[model samples]
Target: MDKLTIALPKGRLFDPVVEILREAGVVNRELDDDSRKLILEDEQLEIDFLLSKAVDVHTYVEHGVADLGVVGKDVLLEAGASVYEVLDLELGSCRLVVAIPEEAGITSLEELPSTGRVATKYVNVAQEFFDQQGIQTEIVKLNGSIEMAPLVGLSDMIVDISSTGRTLRENNLIEIAEIARSSARLITNRVSYKTQHQRIKNIIDDVKAVISKQ
Candidate 1:
């Protein structure tokens, strides 16, 4: 079999996938060395590993540059890119929510003013959510640290992902509305899934087996 190229999301999802591969007998035990580059190769299994941002993993796999990818549901929906979401890895769990200052006294989505300001990394998703709620608001796009926006009065509220709510709490914010739920997902290119069906199926099945027993 030819080498399989796998795109791994660099941050939170990296270690989990790497551990899975190690258990499945595909990754080298010494792959996590700090001095070594993040990308690694396993000659015995003909596997090539590349580290990429969570948002870019889907694009890399969708473009066929990688045979498989691990990405978060938040990023997947935000991109709206074409790809096969094969399995839910059930890792890096979080929820997409609308948060605001505690003193704002917001109790429900309907209670928000018709014309308000909203900040988020997920601009499209936030707009769609507000549209569905029949609320009109300004959408502000922030590249990083969205929580800080509401703190500094840049925006009235923010649509962002939260896992433990620690960041929001520290920033003196509270979640007023939950837009959606998200988790880490295993994805692949459509063409690659078709061309390398058996190999891909084997990997998928391996993951499913592990998930089923958990």
Candidate 2:
């Protein structure tokens, strides 16, 4: 069997994903979140794990650097990368939403200026969503702190992933619309899925079984 490489996102989803892998008997050693190592191997399972930023998981899998990856649906939608999303792990649940300042007096997309500025880390997702709604807006790509955009006059609104509405409320932002619900998913490289069918199937089945028990 060819050695399988799996990519795990390093954030809120990390610990849960590691626990699932352990339950599926795919990982033998304890994974230290504080470890500096980017790669970990389990000889018994013939697997190598790559810890990466959530946004980079798709890139690693799409480039075939890793055979499998655990990432959020939000990243997948934003990236639009060519990778086979095989299963929803049901972890890291969140929503992609459009938000505006509480005092903006914009209760709906239609209330905003015909041409406005939107800020987000998810540029692609934001563009697609607004374009589909026939709303023309300039997208400001921000790597972090999207909430500050509207507050500081950088943008009129923002598209961001929200697990809870707490952050938005605290920042005096209101969710104007929900673009999509997001959860962690199991994705595989297209070629790897075809070339390592049985092995990959076994791993998927193990994960499904564990999820079923939960």
The lDDT leader among the candidates is 2
Q: Mark the 10 consecutive residues where model 1 has the least summed lDDT.
A: 27-36
lDDT of 2 by residue, 94-191 (tens): 99999999998888877877788999999999999999988898999998989999999999999999988999999999998999999999999999
Query: Candidate 2, 183: how far from true, in Å?
Result: 1.0
In candidate 2, residue 17 scores what lDDT? 94
Stretches > 4 Å off in candidate 1: 33-38
Error of 2 at 152 (Å): 1.1
TM per candidate: 0.93, 0.96
Positional deviation of 204 in candidate 1, in angstroms?
Answer: 0.4
- Misplaced by over 4 Å in model 2 are none
